[model samples]
Target chain A: MLGDCRDWHDVSVIEVQELTKTFGTVRAVDGVSFTARPGEVTGFLGPNGAGKTTTLRMMLGLVAPTSGRALINGRRYVDLERPVVEVGAALEATGFNPGRSARDHLRVACTAAGLPTRRADEALETTGLKEAADRRVLGFSLGMRQRLALAEAILGEPRVLILDEPANGLDPAGIRWLRDFLRHLADIGCTVLVSSHVLAEVEQVADHVVIVARGRVLRDAPLAELVRGGELKVGTRQPEQLRRALEEAGATVRFEDDRLWVSGVDAEQVGRAALDAGAVLTELVEERSGLEHVFLELTRAEMGEAG
Target chain B: MIRLIQAELLKIRSTRMWLGMLGLSVGFALMGLVFYIALAGVEMDGREALPPVTDPDTVRAFYANASGGVLFMMILGIVGITGEYRHGTITQAFLVTPRRGRVLAAKLVSYFLFGLAFGLVTVLATVAVALPALAIRGGSTSLLDNDVPMILGGTVLAMGLYALVGLGLGALIRNQIAAILVAIGWVQLVEAIVTVALPQVGQWLPAGAVRAITRTTGGFGGMGELDTLPPWGGTLVLVGYGLVFAVIAMVTAVRRDIG
Candidate 1:
């Protein structure tokens, strides 16, 4: 029943079907299933120890599942003839040898995959690591290591990319560069799956999200849908009157940072309320519900220090 | 398979271990040459007539006194895989080549050649020492001896076999320092104590088998703590140790999750 060959939108780069992993009595991943389709930056979101890494490992065939399967390109990863060219993965940022230079590290990957040695230099350029290519990884900053890992992951120019916590050690500027790079990757039809615990990090890059908690998926929905319910942020000179006015207008208002967060109301409604209340309005904007808020709400009950 | 081997070679090409092993083998042999040259005729233990190794059976017996330091090949083998685990790079290695059986096989084969190369270098150093020492002691070099080729070949094979055993140990024990300690303890203390206490059983063990493999130049003398198997038998036994480790690794590695 795999007949949707021509429809690129219907194709899945990653599909995990009822994947479960047990360590003794502890079930790390309990029948988890999710899909990451092509041409989208899908964020695999979960709290710490929420089976995210385990599931990714299982997908890449690094960890065996207790039951069920994880498939990439309609086949198991082990069955892939040229895994590097088809699936580029960077599970850990610091997986390169410390003694080897960054260029040498990528060369090893290129050599193993039988890709041209030139691809190593191309990858170095892609990750903006060309200046530090000759330096050994021992001296690399965490951000530099993450970049090297990205370079190695993209060495084979793979169609699908799987990265786990790709931005754990980046500065603000580096994070911005990463967001743009991943967006560009997805724009060019390369499926990108990046797993992260932080919401603000993924919210800016992820087009789709699969959030998990306590070894179970809490939601598998588009980012826009998950963060649909938001508040109208109002910055006013008179916070008390704006809050009272917004409240009188059947809106729930909370004071935050010299502004009234008007929930159950739109930006236009907040502006009209401020004008009607004769309060000076400086800034009024609709603040969408952040993935962090949605994530916390969905996972609060399940996050009882279980793991 | 060739690419995998090349990749494995690249992993260790710049490590200090290879240079250290080279220095170890050559240094030990140089020290032996110095000792034999200066004191070949000096009275020791009050036996004026007998030299340190008079008319010894094989070159390794000489190297046993000079430098059997190639015994470190097994340790090198352990570090090969364990180092990957220690540095958390096995994840990348496996990701690039997901069929772990292929990776394991490639490791063993690649490391076997790696071990063999060092084995030859160790022998070359030993010979370099022997050439001068023999001339100084008024003795003929054993390079042209008919048995030299087989003994040297066996010595190299012995080294390669130790590497296989080391690879197995690394697989069974993923921790680098722990695996290294076990390897050292096994080769130095355990085997020595066992050969001394139980010669019959120890001869069938790997260390005893190594004697047969390395001392096949005509007679047994070097690392000869116990009565050893024939050269061919020792080859099989030494190889058996590597195969046993590989068999155990093959069964256990896939069961546990890689990092």
Candidate 2:
């Protein structure tokens, strides 16, 4: 590899700093920063309009940032002599010519990067598109198109792959194949940045996660750190009163509708508090914090704050 | 640069649009032959009814008149570039080659080569069909004449420029239908009306200049005592259009988001 992969403790393949993009008065990507290290799949988690695509576009030099910078291999994407060989990207699935065969599509990419034509055929086979390599893309399903896009991305065996919503329109088998393929790419020292609104799918593949909301980064941490604590939901007739009691007892209490959400407190403590307060507890359950729940909780809190 | 050009050529070769355009070029050449035969038949029946057809210059004029169908080939050249934008393939193209300037350059070179080859073939086929009809009508004309070379050169140049213009339009609009409409309306309808109704102003317009240099007398009949720019000058004007539009397209392509 041209870049450091063994020295993962020091190598940061991509470093985005305070990136911002504005469309008129609305900021699409506002002051977002994150780093993707070598040999890891970093999930760019965000909602539909949370600026994931804009940030990825800025990173790839497709859309220039209004402020700050995104560097790949310690250099801007445009500054790289061989962009396709340095950072392969598949922004959207339909970004292909329906009239072109899959092999020809990869051939164009390889030619652009000054790679050997053999790489195109190799990538087609790797992506499981060899059987359909000669078929025109017009007849391809969305899943097939996604595979073709992936094949194009990996044509030059780029060190870094930036894919936006790569799992969209894929069957279970295709998704599993994608997960395994991306993991395999990472295993070979490639830095993968996969963006999607689907948290569970990304959580399955990404080693690290960066959550963005309202054009800003809310959290960036390893997957283990993100899904560390178990969340306990306690529903009571007097949720406000229950929240105060939990806070007084030195517990982190969050109130939502008629439910009292208590983190840093176990279900037993919640039951004990309900018994002590002589309150009838209709519901008390300890729930695991999956990526989806974390995403919803983080984005919902950000939305409430904005409102 | 060579690799990029090869990639672009490969892309064009793999598309059905290229095949369709080739077929259309041959069809236009056949139409030219039909026109030449019909004109020759009419001329043999009554020589005094139409313009004089005596000298080699008159024979060249006859070929030019019959080969007017070749103008459609130029339209096909324009569509070639715009078709990619309309089909949403430019995204894949740019992703493959992030250097926007180099990609545009490759497109221009590829389109120019294609237009040149197609234009040459169409002209050759038209002459092959038209020369026999001219000989039957007692008119002496050789396809290898000096005037024929100049005419073919000018037509090829015109086709190349039009293709570039279409490329520029495709980049600016990013929609196939809109680009085609603008190209067709400007080249065929708008220029036809303007050159006839307003000769002085239309001479400076891009399509008018191209038509003026390519066709001889009686092309724009309403432009009385037509004073037009030289063929090279018209070519320069078309090239200028291509460059300006291409630059705009390049900037927009780099600046805008892919969505």
Candidate 3:
């Protein structure tokens, strides 16, 4: 889906190696590791209280990790000469002084980043907040605040973007817009690492997914690869006969409600086995699993193990 | 570094609190000057006779008391640091300039300047009221003679230095309300009582150091003047307090994680 790639270099890569953070007696983030490359949207997916925010904070140097590192382009965040020019982070929507105007907020960020103040206006236009540019943030809705946060994040046009739950307060239309925005950013070779508790939102926009549970990485892979292999659901009158034939054909078959849930074989193989068994097929469809199912299953399994 | 300082100044200037604080500061300075002028040379039952405005000491006292607005400058400095945590903007501040030390250093410089501005306005207001009132009250307009200019310079320095002290305190105590309360309570009550009760010990405190800067003598409520350090000595003590607090704050902040 990425086009118009800008020959992006490896300097935009984000590397988190064995990062961990502990608060008092609670271990918030424990040994999390992942890498996000340029030109791809990496979704850091997890449930609430699963250390996603803590990890992101550590990555941005807002929090110190116990025993590991989160490096952007082989340098620590605090070591970057001009951090905003290289990486932009919008940790939350509430990171605003309510009394300050929206334009002034971005202008502060722009000034800190050593960018021209006019970029603040450009970012306002980009985020569709030009009209509210002069208004104090106290009057803004949560969705507008989220938009303003996004606008601030992109003020420097940094090569790397780290946004935590960018779609939290957005409406459906706003979510769609954010999805497209992220895709456009990735298309232009910006490394985007977005964290979300909602799997569907990330599933729509993330090229790569890093699923975490209880402060541990569960599954990390491309979205396409994770959702590629799925079970096939075969409906028939003779469920017992279809199960026997499918098992004999080296397929794992389970009979449930007059249907056979078949795995370990493709639809074509299942059809051939049904024909040989003279099973009157009612429905045969590939149940390609979405990230939601895999996410639920992995997180559930992890929870079960912990419990 | 300059950009960071500019950002810090912008952050302060964009807020309405600074303007309100400025108004209050100027008003407080003028109010104190007018009250002192009205009461000059007047005697009350069970109290010492008021010294006339022509008295060099009384005139010096007017300039010294003119710095009542220093309290607001301290608050401005405190808000400069604590507001970031209160509003959750420190995260963005750090993100924009990852080196937390630089962010704090910028704040220290900016708040110092802000406090200086507040001091300048209050000083000008004091001169406006003191000169006219002194002239009408048959006092010499020799306000610029002798230690008067020294006292004025010291007042400005006290305001600027106190701001750094406030910034340091705010950094050490991130809670906005708690820091503000501690600052006000200490300056207005605890320090006042301590200075009155134990002149030797109180003279070493931050407030006493300020009195030294302005060469303020005598205590509240007809109490006798406590022994104070020389003006330069007071400036040294106050600067030492600011530096110590700032160094401690920087050390703690560099290690403390932002939650």
**Which number leads on TM-score?**
3
Clashing pairs in 2: none
Candidate 1 residue pairs in backbone clash: none
Residue range B40-78, candidate 1, lDDT tens digits: 556767754224434544233454432265457777888
Worst ten-residue run, lDDT, model 1 chain B? B216-225
TM-score-best of 2 and 3: 3
Number of the candidate with higher lDDT, 2 or 3: 3
Candidate 2 C-alpha lDDT tens digits along B52-144: 445554555555542354445445545655565566566666666767788878877777777677767767776777677677777666666
Q: Is candidate 1 or candidate 3 better by TM-score?
A: 3
Once superposed on the true structure, which residue ranges of model 1 sit more than 4 Å away at CA?
A1-5, A233-261, A270-285, A304-307, B32-41, B48-60, B63-67, B144-147, B216-226
> What ranges in model 2 sit over 4 Å off?
A2-6, A232-286, B40-49, B52-58, B65-80, B144-146, B218-225, B239-256
What is the per-candidate TM-score for chain B?
A: 0.86, 0.83, 0.94
Question: Comparing 1 and 2 by DockQ, which wins?
Answer: 1
Per-residue alpha-carbon lDDT of candidate 3 for residues B1-259, written as tens digits (9 for 90 to 100):
8999999888988889889778877888788777788788787785545677667767776776667777787788788888898999988888887788888888888888887888888888888888888889987678677477877787787788778888888888989899999999998898889888988989899888878887776353321378788888888998898788677567766677887
Q: TM-scores of the first chain across all predictions?
A: 0.86, 0.83, 0.90
